[model samples]
Target: MSSSAGTSTQGEPLNATALNRQLKVMQDRINQLEAQLQAGSGAPRAKAGEGTPKERKRVKLSAPREFDGQQAALAGFLIQMQAYLHFYEDQFASEFEKVTYAGTRLVDKALTWFEPILKDYYENGDQATDFTKKVLNSYADFTEALSRVFGEKDEARRAQERLTHLRQTKMHFAATSTTTG
Candidate 1:
């Protein structure tokens, strides 16, 4: 049989080979473009300062979602309690200095209010104790009171942990310096 170039019924050229080659070239070009974009290697350059990226703000680390609602309510309650506790504690301190019993009963009453809140806080799964931070003065007063009245065991443990951490850090730095040198 003789080889002949044939046209289809519609009189159009039936160049299957040419169509396949063109399709393959187009596919290769598309794949190459995709690869470049994926690799971030051949993208269009951005104008300096015009499209310059801003430094991203650091995200605060959050506790597990389970504690979100309880934590917020606990924080508000703590703030309110802290303010009253501080006022009374200060009043008591002043009165004691003057050998007066004024506000003594009020201070005891305040302590009673705080007992359940503290118990629940310690019992919660995540012991995230730093709360009541809305008012700086109040928070500071509360923290001071906590250390004075309630945080003895925690304060001692924290101090000991800090000392150990400092010692370990010093040793690490010294070892690293020796190795590098």
Candidate 2:
């Protein structure tokens, strides 16, 4: 309607002021879109229990209870330690960090067992050696050491008992099945 209205057609050129005004409008629209994107309001939001993917939350797990080498608690203690290490894997970037954290969770008899390895590693600097330092540096080695030192004392008896029970169960099932021949 007026000269300062929209763009002119029929080979009409836009003056600098109109061009600047159009640029300002475009820049303002761009700023609005950017703000909307940053605020997470531009995309349609999914309802509760919907399939909008979300970042996995990092749950803060309580520290594992101290392990005092009780045979019963050993398995549970190791499980807790493993869960702790797995959940906080990013925090423990190296095997040293993982093993050291596990070592700190030990107490009493467990602490006693870990002390020698800790001392050796600290005294030797790196944990790459095939000795005590190796155990201190590797999570797998450390867990294996713990299992060997504190695993079920009557493991053979327990396994044999399970096998005997399994054999009896198999015999019962075989007896119940009538063969048609």
Candidate 3:
């Protein structure tokens, strides 16, 4: 038999360079399709702000402390929660997960307050109470609602009022507590 050149489907003989290029192209296409298939197979996707789980930093984390329903403590709780979430963001795959997590960190009066909100969200699904619906859709909404409920705005206002009305009392010089002649 005579030695034959590498003939492609179009009767064009593929040299070593051309054949290698075609193989590489086929391999790249297979990888691309495989990735799409994996992505479409109901796999959980990370939230926009959170990167994929595998990419998460595995650092020592100190979680936020439990928050009781105290207006003065709300700011510190939010800051701690934000820092903790930042470190372990990939652990949560959805907005609901994050909201639920924050709920789990509540204690005493705060937990009591959150129970109904959590229930409304879980039992009602997408049709939960307005605040619950907002929180379920976004972590920011949840924190904002939490702040409104347990924030120091009212306390600050009351303190402001007291400060505005502050004045030195007028004391009579003759009216002394000690015996005087």
lDDT of each: 0.44, 0.80, 0.80
Worst 10 residues of 1 by lDDT: 97-106
Give me the displacement of residue 142 in model 2, in angstroms: 0.5
lDDT of 1 at 119: 52
Off by over 4 Å in 1: 1-14, 42-61, 64-181
Roughly what TM-score does model 3 have, to 2 decimal places? 0.54
- Candidate 1 TM-score, C-alpha based: 0.21
CA lDDT of 135 in candidate 1?
14
TM-score of each: 0.21, 0.64, 0.54
CA-only RMSD, every prediction: 21.8, 6.7, 13.6
Model 1 lDDT tens row, 155-175? 578888888887343434334
Residue-level lDDT tens digits of model 2 in 122-157: 676764357687676689989988998998868999
> In candidate 3, what are the lDDT values of residues 67-178, reduced to their tens digit?
9998778889999998988777878898878888998899988888889988887798877878777876788998988887888668788999999998858964675487
- State the TM-score for model 2: 0.64
> How does model 2 fare in lDDT?
0.80
| Candidate 1: pairs in clash | none
Give stretches of model 3 more than 4 Å off. Answer: 1-57, 155-181
